[model samples]
Target chain A: MSLQLLFDALSLGGIYAIAALGIALIFGVMQLVNFAHGQFIACAVFALILPSSQAVAELGLGRLPTPLLIPVILGFGAALALLAEAAVFRPLRNAAPVALMVASFALGVALQNLLLVIYGSRPKAVSLWAGLGHPVQIGGAQVPLLQLLVIGAVALILAGLALMLKHSRIGLEMRAAAQDFGMARLLGVRANRVISGAFALSGALAAVVALVMVAQTGVADVRMGGQIMLIAFIATVLGGMGSLAGAVAAGFAIGAASALLQMALPAEARPFRDAFLYGLVILVLLFRPQGLFAPAGAKPRV
Target chain B: MLSQHTIRRRMAASTPLVLALGLLAFVLLATTMGDRATARMATETLIRVTLVAGFWIFVGNSGVVSFGHAAFACVGAYVSAWLTLKPAMKGTLLPGLPDLIAAADWPALPAVLTGGALAALLALVSGAAILRLSGIAASIATFAFLAMVNTIWANWTPVTGGTSSVVGLDRYVTPWVALGWAVAALIAASLYGLSASGLALRATREDEVAASASGIDRYRHRLLAYVLSAFFCGVGGALMGHFIGVINPDAYYLNLTFLMLAMLVVGGIGSLSGAVAGVLALSLAVEGLVRMEKGVTLGATTFALPAGSQEIIIAAAMILVLIFRPAGLLAGREITLPARWVTGRGTTHNGPATDRRET
Candidate 1:
């Protein structure tokens, strides 16, 4: 039972880590918290299905072979994020943080409703890699292969991101931008390119989340990404807003907490798990307003 | 010359009052001239006005974007439901409610007031802790507060009916009732903005370090505004419940949170006038698009977009407005009597001809 629960925690934690990373990436460069990131995830998931109001989803990209399918969906997600940056965010670049946040919220609303119009409000079944759902035994513990894959994928992505941030030129620029955007710009970082790059990577991360979510749930719903996005957003805050590694750590912490709460709660109290989880979030914030793992200077200098 | 200058200054200062009266007039016109459905729509819009006004009380002055005021509304709605529902019905649907609350069948006005008071008390308690946080951290904390409220309201079935709709509200919130609450909210918000505390809060918003250096207690002002704002939002929530004659926890969640924020942001998040204008403009646009989706007659033919196009179009409009005018359509300026009219009087005041940023 404990082993199974561990896998559940790891799987959920991996998904949340990826989602939080996406949010942290964008927030690092731009102070804007993209409320629309969830919508991007939903859009990527829906991209696999032909637009239909029917309960059963007809494969669009889902029908393609694995190699092509992944790139196409990731590309679509990146393109959508880029479009939003150009059309909505770019114009409001100089606006207050509040205004930028609202613009993102508006963009989220538009994208969500657009999906509603095309795909309808119903949750549609998407059978992608159904075979992966079967349990595989590892040292007397039966866990779903998909859970192991998710755990592995999260580790791989985190390692790759660390390497990129350390070695890649754009990643270096992003790191600099995250520290202080103006200083980076003055130091010859291409502002537009860096911002676009951040959005693209963020969008791609969102797409990966979408793929994982679809594979895990075998369903595509417009509202599916919302709850996860909220969690990821919270994780981003709890991890220290702009810190990628911190976000991952907080994501796992939150997921582990959620898993434990679900396990420990009485049957009747089980549904109130989120309330307890979020209450803990408030408690954490009270003690560490700058987040549990914020970088130096992240604290309010008051 | 002094008298004329005073008149112009008074006009500038009374922007919120004038805006409130204008909304009142609009509400009166809609109720008087339109059908029952339009009156319903007007009532809903006025309720939204109250909510947005309440939102501006905290968000505008403090520059903290809250996604949690709807939780207050949820608390207020359920309080009203607990207070007003029949004892028999409450016993059955909300058996977990304490006997005193379940047995009592208070009138709508007192129930609404009680709801607001209860919500204010909750805010007083929560805001003490929450207001200490700043910026996006505060926002996220509020969101967590909201999620916690939603979870409790969803699961505390005995008292709240869990996720199910709590029916049998009195439907006492007519257009006039809503307008009264809205106007009251506007007046209260306006007065607060002009208050010493409000100015201090705005100072903090503009520059926290400078404000703190100047001896402003940012946390106190934020908490005060938060409590006051929650009071009206609670009232608005009670009105919404009575207006619809039904209440559900889901109704007071993210969708409503974003809607209120959208109205505030699209109208301008900085001023009282922006709050009112945002609600009014967005409500009208939504009404128009909803009508269009229902098909509008155009000359010889009826034309309509798809059924769900209204949400998309409205969202698109909000984005476009933000892109072009990020400060909102009002640009954080109040709707004073035109600058030209004041300038034509040929009297200069102690300040600019038109004081746009009063708050």
Candidate 2:
């Protein structure tokens, strides 16, 4: 039982960590909180299936074999992100953080409504890697094979991201830009290159999250990404705004806490679990407004 | 004999008065001349005006984008519903309400005020902790507060009716009543914008370090604006409940939050006039789109936009507006009398057209 809970927590946390990383990357390079990131996730999911109001979603691009399908989805996500950057974000690059945030929100609304127009307002079932749902016994706990794969995928992505950030030229520039964008630009790091790279990377992560979510739920709804996006947003802030490691750790911590709360709470109080969780978030903010993992230098100057 | 300072102050003051009169004329025209549907739209627009203006009282002055004001509205709506619903109705619908509330019946007027007061009280408590943070952290805290409120309201089944709608509200908020509230909101927002606390708050917004250095308490002023802002939001929420004759937790959630925020931002987040203008402009545009979706007869054929296209178009319009004029349509300027009209023709007025005090 304990092992099963652990896997559940890890899998859920991995999804949030990926989403939070996507949000944190753009926020690191630019101060804007990309509210449209949710739509990006939803768009990627819907791209897998054909546009129809039918109960069973017909496979569109999803019909491709796994090896080909993964790259297609990632590319689509990156292209979408690039298009949004060029159209909406580029023009408002110099606006206030609040203005940028609002613009992103408007973009998200437009995208979500567009999806609604195409797909209709109903959940559609799609069977992708249906065999992966089979239970695998490990240490006397029955866990789905997909849970282990999700964990493995998240670990691989994190490792790859970390290695790239540590070594590659674009990666180093991204780190420098994240730390201090203006300073990095002054030191010859290309602003457009770094921002675009961040957007593309963020979009790919969103696509990965979409794949994982669809594999788990086997259903795609227009509203699917909204809840996870909200939770990921909270995790991004809790982990500290621009701190990548912090975001992942905080995401895992929240998932663990949520899973534990589900087990611990009385039946009557279980429905209010999110209230307790969000209340705890406010308390955490009160005590550490700079975030739990933010570097000392990141603190706002009086 | 008016000094230049007095003349400018009066001119500045006329902005809100003119806005109020404009709303009043709209309400009168709609209620008197137009059909029932027109009156309903006008009433709804005025309620939005009240909400947006109330929201501006905090956001415009403190320069803090709060995602939590809709939660306050939700609270006010529920609270008013608790007080005004028939006693037998409450017993059946919300059996968990304390005997004092469940047994007593109240008139709409006092109940609405009570709702606002309770929401203000909630803000007072929440803002104390939330105001301590600054910048995006504060904004995140507000978002968390909103989530917590939403969760509680959505799940507190016995008292809140969970996700179900509470129906049979009195619908006392006619166009004129909504106009009264809207005009009152505009006046209150304008007064707050010009008050010492508002100025101090805006000072903090512009340059926090400098403002704090000048003996201004940023937290105190922010909390003051927050409480005041929530009061009006609560009132707006109560009025909305009465106007629609139904209240649901979902109605006051993210959709309302985004709608209010969109209106505020599109109108220019800097000025009171911008808030009112944004609401009116967007509301009218949305109404026209809704009508178009219902089909419009032109000559030989009837044409109509597809359903849900209005939301997409409006969002696209917002993006275009932001791209073209980042500061919003009015660009933080109040709709005051022209400088030449005020100063007389001979001297060319060289002062900036924008409201310097706001931005």
Candidate 3:
């Protein structure tokens, strides 16, 4: 009922939407689950949490402005995405989807453990919040100014994404390939390159979300990746795996529902928040099968 | 391809011996581990081996992956847990039940059988609803089934104790008891692997459309394998509950499901010996590796390697097998009673003396 609670829920939704979009972007291209997706979120959070992100904050791009931190995280995410594609996905390009899915899931486990070896499993806090100062009273309610910034940033990213997918050359190639891989191949679309680019973008989105959330929460745990993986998966499933808009929408829906569920139930029922949210996605799947907002499957379901 | 003859000869020389060795190890380990650890390990492995075997039964035969098997395990674990716990709790939580189940106490026997039956019942009911969809939808639907069970167990706390681990069961399992079940599982798995229907299952696994054209009811056979798999999985769960003396909902997580899967793939999908080998080898590797991890903590810093080494090892092993031997370690190939010993019909170069593996 409180404005603070409502805004908090929105911010959480925004964070989830960003992470889900990252997963959806890659999935939208090649239908790979990118099981390592959670690891991407983890990598970004760890990258930001390391003393390096702090050192950056103390100097050049770090202290420049809070807004600039966004791209630093994004760039880091993009690089990781490319590296993952090169190392994990590319090698298995010709393999069956299940085989790839299984391998990537294995990669996800590997990525999580790699973080464990480096960070040693003790939670770390990324000081992205250092400059943000404090909360402000918006109307009669106290709200963190940092959360509003994240929501605004999410809007900007979504707009930029829309532009990229709708108007950019690489995006065009990616879309073409997704629409028809064989035909796209015949038409001179380099399937591997388009998918790799998509992965880079997906990885970037995961980083941006991680930076925002780490700022809000102030702790970067290795398990953050698993949470994102599950949320992104639910969003992907609910949105129809390859549809970005659907993923974004489902992401927001899941986020808001999870946040609200915290208030709606007692402490005992809180852990069931995700369980209920995923269960809703399942029900939607039972009937829609394709997705609630499945672009190609739109007519029949609606 | 290494000429068909070479492949055949290699398979002929290697298969039976490996299968025998693998099966021998599982039995010896189960028996030699003595009562306590054996009961614990054997029960958990039995349940898992059943899950993997069931998965292969459907996944191998139908070539479709079902991600929702944990749902059935949850169904069986909770159903049996509930039925057994219900009798005890009626005198407490469910004071409303009739005095028979309410006031009376039926022993563990009624509970476990009821648990397995209940799990199968849920599967039958759920199968009726979702079995018609094939491929991705089916996979997702099964995932939904797992989510549904997860949600039910979480919300219906009086029965499952929600996300908190379920406890207070009264059975201390012995390895001998679990060994009996393990042997039963092996027999069931071997018999299923060799049955007339086993051939049908294998046929379906090879090519569903072709098998269907040959007049096999693909759905019926898949459903049968799935239910049977659930039955074994349920038995395994009951044994596990008795063995560990505690049951947390988290125990049946997707990661755990994947653990069973990793074992199967690495063991060589579809083969019975492979399933046993996968479970025993991986279980030891995992448990062994976890206990070996080192940990440290400093001011505001608690560092743990966690029990994660085994998972990484299994994952690495799985990727290697998938890359090199995608057909699985054994594929559908059997380790029949070393051909010459069984039939005496064949030739030499592999000669009688050479065939006598011991000499």
Candidate 4:
């Protein structure tokens, strides 16, 4: 039971960590909170199923082999992100953060409603890789093979991301842009290239999250991404707005806390877990408005 | 006999008066001449006006975009429902309510005021902590507060009927009543915007360091606006419940938050006139699109937009507005009387006070 609980926490935390990283990546380069990231995730999920207003979703691209399917979905996410950047965000590049945020929100509204038009509002069941649902004995706990894969995937992705950021030329430019965008540009780092790269990376992460969520729930709902997006948004702030490491850590922490709260609280009180979690979030902001991992220099100059 | 200062003030004041009269005209025309549906839309529009204006009191002045005001509205709606619902109905529907509330019944007006008051009290408590943070952190804190309130309200089943809506509310909110409240909100918002605290808050918004250096207590000023803003939001929520005759937690969550924020931003987030204008423009646009979706007979054929296309189009329009005029349609300027119209001269300078950026 203990191992099962630990696995539950890690798997959930892994999902949130990826989502948080997606949000943190965009915010790092362009100070806008992309509310449309949720829509992107939803779109990716919907991409797996053919466009239909019917209750049972037909497997569209999910019929493709795993290797090809992964690339197609990732490409879809990246292309959508790039299109949004060119159309919606590029013009508002110099606008106030509030304006950019609101514009992103409007874009989200458009995308969500568009999905509703195409797929209908009902939640659709799409069984992808049903074999992964079988349980495997890991120590004392019977964990689903999918959960273990999720944990492994999360670790691999994080490690690969860290190494790429540390070693690659584009990664270094991204870091430079995130730290001081104007200075980096003055020093000859291509602005558009870095920003577009960040968006694409963020979008790919969102696609990964979509795959995990669809596999876990075996259901695809238009509103599925909204809850995760909101939680990821909170995690992004709690981790320090622009800090990738902080966002991932915070996301994992929040997921673990949520799982623990679900276990610890009385049955009647379990439904109010989010209230307690959000209340804790407020308290944390009060104590560290700059976020938990915000560098000392991030403190606003008075 | 009027000094230039007094003249400018009156002209500036005419902005809200003109807006109120325009709303009054709309309400009167809709209720008297239009069908029941049109009248209902007018009332709903006025309620939105009250909400957006109330929202403007904090967001416009403090320059802090908050996602939490909808929670205040949710609380206000529930409070009004608890106060005004038939005692017998309350006993069955909300048995967890205190004896006094469960047993006693009240009229709509007092219940609405009580709702607003309770919401204000909530804002005072929450804003005390939230207003201490600045910029985006403050915005995030407000979002958290909204999430906390939503969870509590959605799960507090016995008292709130859980996710199921509280039905059979008295539909006492007529167009006239809504117009009255909307006008009152407009006046209050205008007064607050021109008040010392409002100016101080705006100063803080423009430059926090300078404002604090000038001995402006940013926290206190922001808190004041927040509480005042909550009062109006509460009133608007109560009115909405009375208008729709149903109260649900889902009604005042992210959708409502974004809707209100969209109106505020699209109208121009800098001024009170912008708030009212945004509400009016968006509501009319939405109503028109909804009608189009219902199909209009044009010549020999019926012309109609696809169902659910209104939201998409409106969202697209909002994005276009942001892209083209990021400051909003009004761009932070009030719709006041022109200088020539007021003073009978072609004076280009419309007093510095007319500019939202200036104190």
Report per-candidate DockQ: 0.67, 0.65, 0.22, 0.70
TM-scores for all candidates: the values are 0.94, 0.95, 0.78, 0.95
After the best TM-score superposition of candidate 4, give how far the Cα of residue A207 lies from its true spot, in angstroms. Answer: 0.5
On DockQ, the stronger of 2 and 4 is 4
- Residue A20 Cα positional deviation in candidate 2, in Å, after optimal superposition: 0.5
Worst 10 residues of 1 chain A by lDDT: A293-302
Model 2 Cα RMSD, 1 decimal? 3.3
Least accurate 10 contiguous residues by lDDT in model 3 chain A: A51-60
User: Order of all candidates by DockQ, from best down to worst?
Assistant: 4, 1, 2, 3
Each candidate's fnat, listed in order, reads 0.80, 0.69, 0.22, 0.76
List model 4 lDDT by residue over B1-359, tens digit each.
Answer: 55787668767777787788778888889989999999999999999999999999999999898989999999999999999999999988998999999987998889999999999999999998788776776887788789889889999999999899999999999999999999999999999988889889999999989999999999999999999999999999999999999999999998888789888888889988888889988898889999999999999999988777888888888899898977777889887764445665555664533433221
For candidate 2, the share of real interface contacts preserved is 0.69
What's the lDDT for candidate 1? 0.88
After TM-score superposition, the amount by which residue B346's alpha carbon in candidate 4 deviates from its true location, in angstroms, is 14
Q: Show pairs that collide, candidate 4.
A: none
lDDT of 3 by residue, B334-353 (tens): 56444444344455344333
* Residue A219 lDDT, candidate 1, scale 0-100: 98
Clashes of 1: 0
Say which prediction, candidate 3 or candidate 4, comes out ahead on lDDT.
4
> Candidate 2 lDDT, tens digit per residue, A1-302?
89889998998888889999999999989988888999999999999999987999999999999999999999999989988999999998888888788888889888888998888888999999899999999999999999999999999999999999999999999999988888999999999999999999999999999999899999999888777877788888889888888989988988888888888899999999988888777788788877778855576566
CAPRI verdict (incorrect, acceptable, medium, high) for model 2: medium
